[model samples]
Target: MTETLASTSSPTATSGGTPPPEAAWINAYERLSPRWQSSALSPQSVIPIAISRVNQVDAGRLDIEMSAMLKEQMVKVFSVMKPGLLFQYEAELDAFLEFLIWRFSIWVDKPTPGNALMNLRYRDERATDMRGKIRTGLEGPGLTVYQKILYCIATVGGQYIWTRLQSFSAFRQWGDSEQRTLARRAWLIVQRIEGLYKAASFTNLLVFLFTGRYRNLIERALRARLVYGSPHMNRAVSFEYMNRQLVWNEFSEMLLLLLPLLNSSTMKNFLSPFSKDKASGSSGDETLCPICQTNPTTVYLALPCQHRYCYYCLRTRCAATPSFRCSRCSEPVVAMQRHGGSVP
Candidate 1:
């Protein structure tokens, strides 16, 4: 994979569009009544169930009941999820992993839900807030890097709201505009992390590590992104599949691995292709990918003669050659295929 100089820059604001100031988020938090904020910030606000522990040696046991907020509302919000999974120490983490397994299984076994986050509302009535629409505006046919970053955040949040909330509550509770901005930051963080992990230069790590057991499912999850450079997709659900538990499990596992990556700055680098001007349709002639025609695939020059080919096509053709031969000159095929293929 190509290494772009790493920078700790803040995620770009929507081009031609300004971001709401930080105070806007603070203001949103302020919008919540004092009582709500007081409660929300408290550990009890979200967890209503009572927690009890006993010291075996002392034989002194303490039981504390959860606040009404948890019993009446918060827990209900998450009731669809298994109990003892939210914050059950090690057990909780394991539960989370199991949740992922269930989620992925759903994607693999059934028809994935269409418009996963279509219901999400945007603060500005004129502005589209549905994840798909916002995503299109940001990473659609002619999106910019800024746009792709924006969309990645939106799309990630839309699909993985629960997991993200578990890891970053501040983001979950953010106001509409604030959520967008924070989501951008989260995406950058993940990108950087993924890059760091990838720097080791293992081409098959994603495949080798994640492919077995969930092989078909993994491919389905990654296929559109790898092939079309689009990350906003409604998962495919198989017909007659009602195994929700299995589906949720797979999704849960996928998120545990995916959430951290999206939160890393290095991991954000992988999003380059999605934001490249080619996808945005801004490059005119320079932008279309020859192989797919829908997006601009990265191009590379062959050795000696410097003939160019779409990175995807070049790989297949070059692999059969001995010295990485130039298609035009039919020279030797010697160029080594890099990890993660080439980015457009």
Candidate 2:
């Protein structure tokens, strides 16, 4: 599991990688009253296709655009949903599947034309018909038996492929024939391991559903990061709203990194969150620290009056004052927290 997470770490660059299949997974998730077709392609493309789909939701005539979109999405849904055919996080899975195909293609079965051993393509009539069904599948029932079988194969094969055994030096050391034999043996062993892992995964999912935990725990302990967003989070929604949270994390990190250079006086002013009681000042304005009696260079903490103090000054005076009260207001300082940016 640790290795699987490590091997599947997405490249920071988003330029080249394909997105995950969400619509298909969603359709698969809720068979009843589904809003959209299960796409066979990249989820990124689904947005445009889905928009067009909404535009033509009235079962309009299959014009060129309609037909093209349907066929394209069907192809994507078909190609993407296949066993061990993933373009992301499936490098190991695909590599291992390649070895399996290599072993199968040997001993009377020749490797297919225009195909690599590590990756196999199946284009039999059944495969074609199944894809066709997916395109028009909603008009009838959900995925057929053949489709279910494919998903089952895909699941098991995906779990096995998650092992990333192909990258192992020992596996590469084996000669072609030896590797084929080993593939068969490894296939059997993986079945047992897959069952165990699947059960563990199901249990973890159950725990996560109940407790809202697991990913964060794994991220902390094993650094096993998520390739996609959290399941509990809203999918098909804008993440721009999280820009604040992102900025906060970055701010916190910067604050920590700069902490060593900041002393009590400097730190106090920088994080000065409190303010003054405006009524106390005849001018109702404060421009300098009352303790220092100088203009503010950074954030000057304000007392409950016209008098201002650097965060350290007021906090120091407040502490020495009776019952830790503010100097200007003389109000009981129940609590104070940091606030404000540099005031220049």
Candidate 3:
């Protein structure tokens, strides 16, 4: 009975002989036992994708600002040369900066400054196989050398070429060429192409909203998708400064809305008593106008206060407000007099 039980559990006994070399042996208990299985990683939500786009926009803005600063420095260096000369090469300067960014970032399989901030990197979707263990749902193969080169050509070179073409066509007035002429036909073709591109972009945007992949047409064409670089890393952006800025912006807007309605003269009169110079009982400067705070070209004196002021400044104030008071002494100015003459 003991021998029969042992034989029944063995693979050789089941086959009536030794198992074939190709067949693998498994313990009965191991075969019957439940194995641990890992759940598949979930697809990324839309929020991170949107944040990545925002980061990209910010990176572009930073690039533009840097370009402007570089241009300013270059202009300073060539200040003695003809003015507006550097403006002619502005487009070239921008293209050069963009090329440097692409050369270092995409070519090296490194995340862009924007993508790096969000812990995201581009992955070649065509080469990625979904069957393997994917820890963050972002695991995939990095862009190949060919893909990187093509990306640079498509993004940087393509944009520069298109821009130049458009500018040249506009400058040459291709649209205003003789009817049915080649130039006119070319212009119409360009317009149609632009419209088609815009329509395609709109469709792509809707699809992206539904699926949360491929933020731009270039990305969609290349199959280079942004994915998280680190499974454990969180977003690096902080909203504290943004919150403060929003609060200040709201406060400034409110002030702007309310300020125009308030009486400027009343507000000035109300705040005048708190003035340090007024409290000290000293007319601040004899040569400088009390209202304008500059050396008066034609000095005049307020009737009761005798504070010196510019002729136009005092005349406009008295004309606008019949009850115009001395800015320094807070006394009613009934009339004005030239600095060396009697009251006029």
TM-score for each of the candidates: 0.14, 0.22, 0.62
Residues forming the 10-long window of minimal summed lDDT in candidate 3: 38-47
Among residues 3 or more apart in sequence or in different chains, the pairs in candidate 3 whose N, CA or C atoms overlap within 3 Å are none
Write model 2 residue lDDT over 76-161, tens digit each, in one string.
66484856545445454443444443344322233222222112222222222333333311122222345434433543464455
Q: Runs in model 1 with CA error above 4 Å?
A: 1-108, 111-221, 225-344
Q: Per-residue CA lDDT of candidate 1, range 1-344, in tens? A: 01111121124543444665676456555655675656646544332211111111011111012122223454556668888765444333333433443344222332112212221111111233333323322232222344334433433333355454545544464433445786767666665765864654254444434432111222233222111122454223243455777798899999998897663433444554576553554435333433345342555644444444567777776565444544333456456332245422
Over 4 Å off in model 3, which ranges? 1-81, 177-180, 235-239, 264-344
Candidate 3 TM-score, C-alpha based: 0.62
lDDT of model number 1: 0.39
**Which number leads on lDDT?**
3
- lDDT (0-100) at residue 267 of candidate 1? 46
Model with the higher TM-score, candidate 2 or 3: 3
By TM-score rank, best first, the candidates go 3, 2, 1
Whole-model Cα lDDT of every candidate shown, in order: 0.39, 0.42, 0.74
lDDT of 3 by residue, 63-169 (tens): 56655776677668878978888777767766776788787888888877667766778889898765444433466789998889888888778888888889988
lDDT of 2 at 85: 46
